[model samples]
Target: MILKRLILIAIVVLFSCSHTVKGQAPDAVKKTFQAKYPEENDPDWHKDDHGYYEANFKIDGIKYRADFNADGTWVETETSIDEDDLPDAIKKVIKEKFDDEKITEVEKVESATKGLFYDVEFKRKGKNKDVEFRADGTILN
Candidate 1:
């Protein structure tokens, strides 16, 4: 009886865990993603908190994450980037405004609504902050 109970519990756990990951993206989302990323064949799909289908893939050794709506509209794409790769305009803003904060991470973002921007995460005195900047040095947030 104990062995049977253990096996049942294991099966329940496995099914629950798999259920979370196995929610396949909609056909529209997959079609749009394929059109956008022709070279990447396989992408790990996940539904974000906002109900957007996110595709995590790699291109030329660089990792990328793209979000698409259920209706097949592309939302955004983001990729980690080095600080030195930032535009001079953005660098100037960081130097001028965020000089006191230590840079933690940077990502280049291309959004359907917001166009293109850089997301710069900073750590200051045990607190974390994120700043978004356009390529021309305009701050969005």
Candidate 2:
């Protein structure tokens, strides 16, 4: 009897998770997202155990991610950016500090805790370097 009960519980848990991932979010969540970013098309959705939804999509050939809470509230967005898209302050720092290093990738991060920042990755020879900088070119790491 105990074994049967355990199997039933397992099945229920699995069923909930089955609809929680891979472009599957509640109608309400989708509605909220649609209203917010009407221009975004065909966003891939994912749900977490803690009632968070994440959307991964691209805009203008640049990749972006937007997260929402269970209530469909926008959490934050992270967008992949090009070296040319970086701000003048950031460009200045990179040019002065890492002139020889090649910028491999850059990301623009926007969050509640840490407003906005740039995550830049540089490559020198075979080694890779990661650094975060504030909008005004203050290197955090």
Candidate 3:
């Protein structure tokens, strides 16, 4: 009985300590997000690993995720895109190098520090790998 009670308590604590908390973002963060995405009335907010606020919202039927600093500074925004929508330069690289791997996900990332890039996720032999590339087909990572 004691062990079961301990397990229950642990489960409760773990759930309560989850990083993502809906509608708990600070006012500054929300305001920043609002200014950037005026059309989105409400965006589900979560705390990221870097302590930044992450807002998940949709625009024009496309899902987007935007990050903001505590003091309302815009950090980055990312949106998923179809594989065929990728730039031709990026497509050529994928065809030459990553053809063997299955494309799992793709995102167009615009970062304040890193500028614009594409993030492509690939799965091979049960392992997933993410690679960042510039629009001109230059690999960032």
Give the winner by TM-score: 3
How well does candidate 2 score on lDDT at residue 27? Answer: 71
lDDT preference between candidates 2 and 3, better one: 3
Tens digit per residue, CA lDDT, model 3, 56-135: 99989999999999898999999999999999999999999988879999999999999999999998676789999999
lDDT of 2 by residue, 1-141 (tens): 999999999999888884446557767768887887798858988765556788888777778887787777777788988789889999999989998887888999887567899999987666788898998999987
Report clash pairs, candidate 2. none
lDDT of each: 0.89, 0.82, 0.92
Return the TM-score for each candidate structure: 0.82, 0.62, 0.86
> Which ranges in model 3 have alpha carbons more than 4 Å from their true place?
1-10, 124-127
Q: Considering TM-score, which of the candidate structures 1 and 3 is the better prediction for this target?
A: 3
> What is the clash count for each candidate, in the order shown?
0, 0, 0
- Predict model 1's lDDT versus the native: 0.89
Pairs in steric clash, model 1: none
Off by over 4 Å in 1: 1-23, 125-127
Candidate 2 lDDT trough over 10 residues, lowest sum = 18-27
lDDT tens per residue, model 1, 1-141: 999999999999876553233238888888998899999888988777787888888999999999989898999999999999999999999999988878999999999999999999999676788999999999998
